[model samples]
Each structure stands twice: as structure tokens, then as C-alpha cells.
Target: MYQPRKRGYRKDNATLRWSLPDRVFFACGACHILAYAFLERWGTPGMQALWIRPAAGQTGNHVFVDGGDWVFDYHGYANRPQFLAHVWRGARRRWPGWDATLVPLPRDVLISEQKSRGYDGLWLREPGQFLHDAMPRANAYLDRFRAPAVRTAR
Candidate 1:
């Protein structure tokens, strides 16, 4: 199981390293087949955003997170869920607390991808990057809850 990082994902470990994707194995007298899965961060920006948004809104500050997204898989239409879970697992290994929601993209994105080549991707938005965008908005959002931090800290 992946743990939450107090801060955010480490660039060195954005890829999910787990062998299996998010799965739900069942035992009911029946056949067995690899089933589809949809991985979730379990926890998400809501909690962080919850605490910071209020402060940023009140202070009229900007918020942003800085980092790059790891390309786990693209156009692997058959294994979309597994690919995402893999990235999630990899991310967990690097930053246990970085519970950034690896939520599924809209169904339309998937459907379109299946039709052609879709950009099945993981938006590994580092907390630091978010602060970057938020700063201008006066959102005042940053990974550093106490003393504000610079992007180079990571």
C-alpha cells in the first residue's frame, strides 16, 4: 500500500512501481479473468486545498505547485487503468504521503483514445508547481505551510 508524503511526490520516484494495478480479486465459484481497474489517490488536493484555499482566498494570494509529469503510458488503450495504477504505485514509492489523486480521466477522453491514439497520461502536478500558479492569484498556496519555500528547495 502507498503511504502519503507529508509534502509531495519526489521527482526521482514519480512512476508507480507496483507489479499489479488497483484490483479487487473475488472468490465466488466462477472463472477468473484479469478485470479492469480504476486507481484513485484515495486522498486528494481537497484536504490540502481545503486548508490552503481559505488562507489564500482570505489573503488574496496566489497558489501553485511545481514539477513535471511522468509519462507512464500513452495509447495503451487496452490497459489504461493498469498504466495509471502503475504510475500511482511508482509515485507512492517515492513520496508515501503524496496522495495526489491519480483519478481517471473523463470517459470521453478514454472513448476518444480508443477510437484513435489518446494521450493517456498522469498529471503529476507537484505541490510546488501549484504554488507557482497560485502565487499570482494571491492564492498564497505553497508546500511550505509555515515559512514559504522556493521552487529550488526540492
Candidate 2:
């Protein structure tokens, strides 16, 4: 007959020490590089450059761009593609007169982690030369989804 040994409570230092499995879990959870890769490969081309600002007097993470023409309640999205698709659809409907040749975010808009309310999507530091060079391609991409223009006789 064998007696079972009782386990003792762990000390504070013991709790602080992570096992190999624990370390691996933490590394995987904190891996922003994987997130960036997904964004680059599958995200809408110019959508990554848009800057989000918190809606005024909002209680939770409600954000907007293009002077409230595009609003996203970040809680609703499960992934990047869903969010970008929603934004693209909303912009098309709300601001049909907008300059489709350019990315939707304004040149003078300021983007900071604080303003973004800690949402971890790509954002532009400045309206860089890349955007200028990329505009024609981005516009071409958008044009594919746009409704054909209607002409009326004067």
C-alpha cells in the first residue's frame, strides 16, 4: 500500500518563474509579426493606411474617419478582412463624391496609439511618397468594385 504525497502552496518566486511551455505560449500570444504578415498579404491595399480617431463623447471603442463618413465599432470585427470590407462598403455608399484616386484618410490627419484606442491595425506615419506612387494602382483596384457612372443628357 502506497500513501500519496500532499502538494504544498507555491511561493511568490515560484509563481513568477515560467516553465518552457508557459514561455512558448507567451511568445505565440505576443507575436505581432504574424499579424503584420496577414495584414500585408490579405488586407485591402490602401485600407491599411487609413487613420482612425475616437468618436467624441463615446463610451467605448467607437472610431471614425473621413469626418464621420466611416465609423467602425471595433468590437464587431473578428478579423482584418471583415473590418476592411465594412469600411470599403460604407465609404462607397456614404461618400460617393469623394476623391477615389486617393486613399480615404486625410493628409493632415494625425494618428497616434492613443487616438486609435489601442486598436492594432496598420496606420501611416505620414502621407508618404509610397501613397503618391501607389495611388493609380489603388484607384484601379477600387474601380473594379465601383458602380458604373450614369450619364444624363442636358
Candidate 3:
């Protein structure tokens, strides 16, 4: 019911947008946030932040252990780099080895508006192929993050 106007729309940067009650699925910041939300520090050692995707819906805003549909809902992240930076930073300190890395999607990615049955509304991916696929908009955000850093040489 509360689909606020979209924010962070920039041709050069990525942004996230979702109409609520409609579910959101994302992984952009999961590897970082999940550790605390899922296991509350005891789970830090094995969690890797190399490549994260965040997805969520209204109910998606909690850690799986936090009980709101799998830990703060990665799906809701939608291209807010500063938010992403914060999440990753917290995760980095929690898991110092997680300095982000180049890990391609598990397979060729797919992005779509359709969601599998039982989902409340809107979706970034179906369960089966999620690790390998990304919704069109979500993938756009990923690409923007993965973009090579511009370097200036003296």
C-alpha cells in the first residue's frame, strides 16, 4: 500500500524501486548482513561477503533469524550504494576476510517480474534458479556495483 516514489535514479549509478505489499528479493548485501541476523556473531566465520545480493518485501526487512522473512530482506535494497556500503562495512568488521571479490552469478542470470506461487507479491527470482538468476532491475544494480573503478594517473 505504501509504494513511495522511487529514489536514487541516476544514469551513472544504480537505484532500487519496489511497490510494497509486493515482495522484493535481493542478494546485494546479504553475505554481510546475514551473519549477525542469522546467527548473531557465532555465524560470522563462514559467511563470505565477496558477492552479495539483497532482496525483500515489506515482510522482507528482517534477518531470517530475526524472523521477518530471512533477515532484513535483501530484495528491498535496490541500488542504494551508501546503504550497501554500510552493510558491507559492518560485515567486513564482523568478518574481516570479506573484502568483496569477483564471483560471477552461479550461472547465466535472469531477471523477471514474475514470481513463483505462494509469494505475497512481486519478486526478483523464483526459488529454483535464484543463485544463478537476477531480476532485470536487480541485475542493473549489480552491474553498477561491479563496474570498474575509474582510475586517475599522475
Best by lDDT: 3
**Model 2 vs. true fold: TM:** 0.21
Ranking of models by lDDT: 3, 2, 1
Q: Judged by TM-score, which candidate is best?
A: 3
Cα lDDT tens digits, model 1, 1-154, are 2232324433333232111121210011000100001111111222111000111112111112211221111111224355446545664565564444322233222213242134322122222333232112221111112321223534
Candidate 3's residue-wise lDDT over 1-154, tens digit each? 1123336532222233222112332333222222222233222332222223223221211222122111223343233355446656765565564543222221112122242112333233332333332344333434333222223558
Candidates by TM-score, descending order: 3, 2, 1
lDDT of 1: 0.23
What are the models' TM-scores?
0.20, 0.21, 0.24
Model 2: per-residue lDDT, tens digit, 53-134? 2233311111222212221221212344555555455554655532222133322222232333334433322112221222
Query: What is model 2's C-alpha RMSD?
Result: 17.6
Candidate 1: where are CA atoms >4 Å away?
1-75, 102-154
Model 3 TM-score, 2 decimals = 0.24
Q: What is the lDDT of residue 103 in candidate 2?
A: 30
- Between prediction 2 and prediction 3, the one with superior lDDT is 3
